[model samples]
Target: MRRALPLPLGLLAALGTPLPSLAAPSVELGQVLITDEAQDELIDAGERLRETPGASNLVDMQRVGQGRVASNQDVLAYQPGVFAQSAGNDGIKLSIRGSGINRAPGAHGSGVYTMFDGLPLTGPGGTPYELFEPLWLSRAELLRGANGFDQGSLALGGAINYVTHTGYDAAPLQVRYEAGSRGYQRRHVSSGQVLGNLDYYVALTDAEYDGYQKHSSGSAKGFAANVGYRFNPNLETRFYLRYRETENELAGRLTKAQIKHHPRAANAAYLARDDSRPQPGSTWVGNKTTFFLDDDSRLEAGLVYHDFPMDLREGPMRLKVAYTDVSGTLNYLRRDTLFGHQSKTTLGWRTTKHLPNSGASQFVRNGDEFGPRSRDFSYQGSDTVLHAGNDLELAPDLWLTTGLAMIYTRRESAVSYPADGGKVSLHDWDYAPRLGLRYDIAPQLQVYGNLSRSVEPPHPWSLIWSSTVATQPIELENQTATTLELGARGDSVLGRWDLAWYYAQVRHELLAVEIVAGLPAKEANASPTVHQGIEAGLDSTLWERPGNGKLSLRQAYTFSDFHYRDDDRFGDNRLPGIPMHYYQGELRYDWPSGFYAGVNTQIASKVQVDYANSYHADAYALLGARLGWDSPKQDWQTWLDLRNLTDKRYAATVTPGYDDAGQDVARSTPGEGFAAYLGVSYSLR
Candidate 1:
């Protein structure tokens, strides 16, 4: 924290303040104010992100904690161009710009690169959900679409970086407890401190719940820690560690009628077999080192190790999957003067690969009893990319940006248990290039445009599971797209607003369809497709009184139009998972005494349930309210959250089938009904 000394009488007199009494001249000084390191860091991060010529969002976890911070779904609310919904467990369906929209929620999710504290968390297989405890985060940054090029993420959905709290932003000791309907409970304890040039932070958390649907309970426990040291003004390093384990029971999907009448009933098959997914454990360890070459240049290097193993007991089979990945990254950043103009340049290299022992085993199951082994398979994959980018100031208040990247990808999958097991191995090279420009129309307004390309590789494990024959592996090509985007963001009379429009010409687009009720879906390369969307967000201070309170409104809306350009069978049919229109808004009133109340709503259009558009999941609107109080000294907090106030029964998520023929298939997960929760926390600073 920084400070300023009290004003001297002489300085006040020089500033033309009149003295009331010469014998006893009095001076009145206001209370000392200290800035929160975390808040300053968030502002600096947002300013840095605004330099990019694309859309992005910075999420403050502290604000999100006022209500409920259950999962990523809660953490990512009110973010335009992003769709995240829970699948009745830790698994959530997350998509950006129609990426990975159809696949069912599972142990691993795709189409985006995820990170924790700037270290790799997404690898060749995909992103795991076990270690994402929302309370461990200080903030989150989302780079949508190709805006993540600087982070070495070459995916359709770009990247998400979760930043954890450090000693500078944490209290010395803190404890929290939460309880609510359906027997939900959670507890947490954490501590952080700074000593000389060294700092450390650690936290422990656990949660359990009796879910809304029968046989859908779940529990989790986790810990996160980090330590950092500054050797000198020019050198620094930090180490990070995270470990978590979770077990959740499964309730199979239900038909439209079932959700309307018996929303809390589990599917008969799921109840009979007691289906569940229990993650044995997940761990991530990493270190990052930085070298300040000079005032205008720097270099950073990082290495990470990740291990996530799963013990899945669902459907008619039990699968034990072992996944481990290792990654390395290096980046160089510098500024220079070229042709008498200011310029900034960056060069980076990164790679991620699966370990030798990454594989899975399957066994037959009946009524919670295991049978003989059925199949054994191993997955192998690696990704390497070298990229360079530059931004040049062509004129005052104007910038030109350009970048290119070369990528190498390898995938291999083999069935090793059965005799003469089939195998598939493929390697390919691809490239992406980008160009963009931005100009400051005024200090409070700016306009930007970018033309870029994106490439996404199929997961190695998908090759084995997507096959028609049980013992064979299939080969598929990489998905690629060329996109054009135009956008602007700035302050206006109404409030802070952002609006963007983008269109992509996708080639060999990857699509997944459910072939069976309880098995991995089949992924195939589509002929061609078109993806277009509009994203808008606004935050306004509706009313304010200096000594009383303030009223504010925040809103986000997305309009998506994604479809097959020309297919022999589907014929320009719309995608089946995401809705065409989505919106979320919150109207809140905050009092100067640390009390606040808010009402929020979420609305979405009908969603198609099949590729043929034979049927749909009906549109729905949800209403909720939150009331909370934060102590003036920031030592304590308490809140009450009410959800689904009208007790509306609707499908919260959908897993599309190939062709239901207009039948209301068992393909939707019911949303939670009316519920209430209470939480409180105390901190000793």
Candidate 2:
């Protein structure tokens, strides 16, 4: 028999409390609000987020922009349970909660779902990399595990939503410029304005870098814009458009010996072929509408269309793909009093259709001529999801939340090359369930626990491609896991802290194995495995003097313990690619005059690099510092950032291998050395 818990009243009290009086009337983008209902809606939305019963975090982009803003790693450095490593200027590898931990370099599959302003960035085929720019976002929301049910995401890694600034949140005019080491330069310009019921915002950016490693360089250009109209205080609609073009050279990986002696050298094979990502680009358009039904209910609908073109050269292979994606979502949220207690319910539906017009793979013997057509195909994929969840108050301070999701996916492809006519189609149906309880111990403290199931299907590329050994196709079974989690968050005299512990039993876990040196890894289902970890974060003010200055400390730590569970082959062997211990911290001092300085460090324990558990990468620690001045009037700001101050030589990331008994191959990408950057920004309102 099973029993359900009641919803907690602490969240309702916290959100319903009256706010303090403001010092002055707020004016945004020189526009005076015509009604107070809009402001109330915003506040209600924020309160609802705070009431969630699981691990969730909101990152303020303004705080992240205070230092180096060049890469995603810089932006997500303080996020617990998230690991982001830079492969180059335009490429980044990201994983959360052991999700996609064994993915190969440049692979098109990810277990984590990513979105921007309520629009899906990951297509139905699960290929999502390269769609983030911190400069264009106002905030980021991270929902871990089952906490993302409201977003209709069933991935083990959970979901991330990047929210962009609107016309009301932007300045009338803004300009920014940055110059850094290795011939790096960036420039951005933006403008926002409002006329009658219409509002609009636009931004343009250009960047170039002579990368840290030899033969590694890149350039990118982007444009983003949004236009909106307010039909009434209860209804509004917005349209978004974005375009970007990028070209980058590959430096490739290096051996441990080479990393130690000549860390900046490019791989010989990569240099021979001049491997590069040439003219990779995308265009996106989306529309979102929201309707507020009374004070207790709201509905949202959105649609997005994306066009992507990719061209790449890797060693002796040339690949080209023309990809298009269409997605739509509908969500309804309602809050009411159930049996004289507060109750909330959410229902969401999402669908995505992906089409690849022509995907071609060719072998090239010379510089400009294609040698042989290895593969050519056209594909269509679709994904549909329905999710519903409810939170009901059972007692004064306790709450119970339950949710379920049903997912259906299909893939169809026709092969036109290889002189053999063939057709392939696959379909799958999966269900995910979640249950959780929350209790409020105090006004500022809370504790929660949850149990959930997650499912992930194989990407189309993985299903169609072949393993390096060529013994069989690379089509893998869907990965599934059952997880249990407990967490606590609070603010006290000591500081603000958020901590969580989770354990998962995974079946048919996807594992990538490097069978051939200097080639893409092969995907396969591994034996039963266990993933457990601890995520902790703390932010505290050590000392403060009224009207003088203050000192603060911020820290985040992650402990990952992933291994096989009494397996037949590699019995209890630890999984590869992730370090057992990873930590990041910062100490800063600020003055009343708007001057601040901070020192930050990152540390990682030795990591296993192969499934055999016989080979490991040495541990490393890096230190960096930054000093900046921010005007109190928010008119001007400048920063000087210094990274890798000690110029340490270490691997930024390592690829996983099956066994390293007699293999001596390069499998690591070297970290950057000492570098400096200076950035300046000015805005007019």
Candidate 3:
């Protein structure tokens, strides 16, 4: 049976709650079906909200029906101030608070940190992993700014944690299948049960898709299992493991003309001197082991290995091992990314059919390494981080949290262009510090703030390996950002509201700059930068009637100003690709007959193209809804999701030549028009 909830505006106002600047309605009231873990972390609905120490948020699985998220990019599309952009239609790069803008294919260097379960996914050198697939994410938590003090690392933008579901709490046996736009299909199965003192979960997922462009066929398969044993009321142990495989053909990006003629043409020739069909694909496998000592202490470690057998691409193979210890009072991490032994290459495509497609394809290397018979190259790095914190009860209702972290990183790059050539090596060291705190005010209100620092070490690519700088040893470049964050959160008659403001001062912002007249370029700290933003959110149950569940609403809004300080070329430019205004809202109503209806929307303000800042993509909004029914007696549910309910044709990307060239250079990937998906789920005991 459903429970009653507080009314959105009426209840909140009646409780004398000061509502944040809300852009939409609040969640409707009713019995909040919270998970066990969530219940343990939060004090109560009315207690002061503290998100740092053991903070996490769960996206209700029952709310998201069977619609396909074309790519992992859609997972956080509704997040405030977050922008997910695709160079083509298949690959995506996420920008948070102006971080990760320069991230491209094979590019290494991430301002943000990404993790799965408790293990780090990004390599030791902060190289972000490609979004393999979004198959088994049970819940996702985005810890930003000082909110991530407990998890020690040189995190600038923030950290994203994806928790996969386990079988213990899942249905005994469940299966699902779905297909969608551009020849896409998927199959998934999961199972879980409890026995005495043990619980277990296992899941399998497979997906294949012929993307919106040429040669854009991607197929992936994954399997995962987790087992937990509760020794007693004070201690619990759990084991988790996952394996994934993928084979994708690169059709690459298309130009404006190609997109207009064939929306799904992956083989379109857009770059005259470019070749993208090098039979490109990669295989990666990862495994993790974790043990929990107590509710506040955990020890986790993992290993990741990847190999790439490319036709024309020449980069590096990856091997990484990481260990992390998290205690209520202290945290520690040791991570490393190493290049393995291997020397090989494949033939370059000779036909125009294999030409790479892109709005700006000149950045891609056109010629292949012809004389490179045998080459030995090694690039390795290790990051050691330590943090210590303590919680002090200042007053009955107020609490203060103090913490500090020290990070030490070492990097080495050795290279020999040809077989037995004279080898050269470059090395460097970096150090960073971290700090933060939270405070509770009135009965239901809390204020938290933090001042921390972060840094990005130089990548192996910056150590001078290209023929353009064969003899010039490039210097290591590092960046430091000082960030300040303040926020207030509470639950009142108005529901749950959170408001925050953040500002950052960055020094030595890294960039690839042309240093010498006759030489190519070197990675260098271009200049300083400043980023500031304001955000507000609300969740509430608007109304409720006995047995009719309740009407719930959730919404968030952000206004950000990201720009650079010093240096030439659009100084103080509104950091390209970041939307100044972003908003998301959802309204849902559930009933006894298992009948449910919901409406969701995402809005983005106009954003500038690349660094030129001469061109910009227009503002756009997409609204969607879902209607479904479930059987009360039978374990069955079905739903239809209508995405992009309003037909709106908008270009997803546009890149103009420097100095406002003549060509439009727009490669608009079509946002899905109004489409409906019908899905069904069943369980077998």
**Best-matching candidate per TM-score:** 1
Per-model TM-score, in order, reads 0.94, 0.92, 0.76
State the TM-score for model 2: 0.92
Q: lDDT of each model, Cα atoms only?
A: 0.84, 0.76, 0.52
Give the alpha carbon lDDT tens digit for every residue of 364-443 in model 2.
Answer: 54544557757676657788889999998889888899999999987665556664445557788989998999887666
Ranking by TM-score: 1, 2, 3
Q: Tell me how many clashing residue pairs each candidate has.
A: 0, 9, 22
Off by over 4 Å in 1: 1-35
lDDT score, candidate 3, position 217: 61
Query: What lDDT score goes with residue 123 in model 1?
Result: 87
* Stronger candidate by lDDT (1 vs 2): 1
The better-scoring model by TM-score among 1 and 2 is: 1
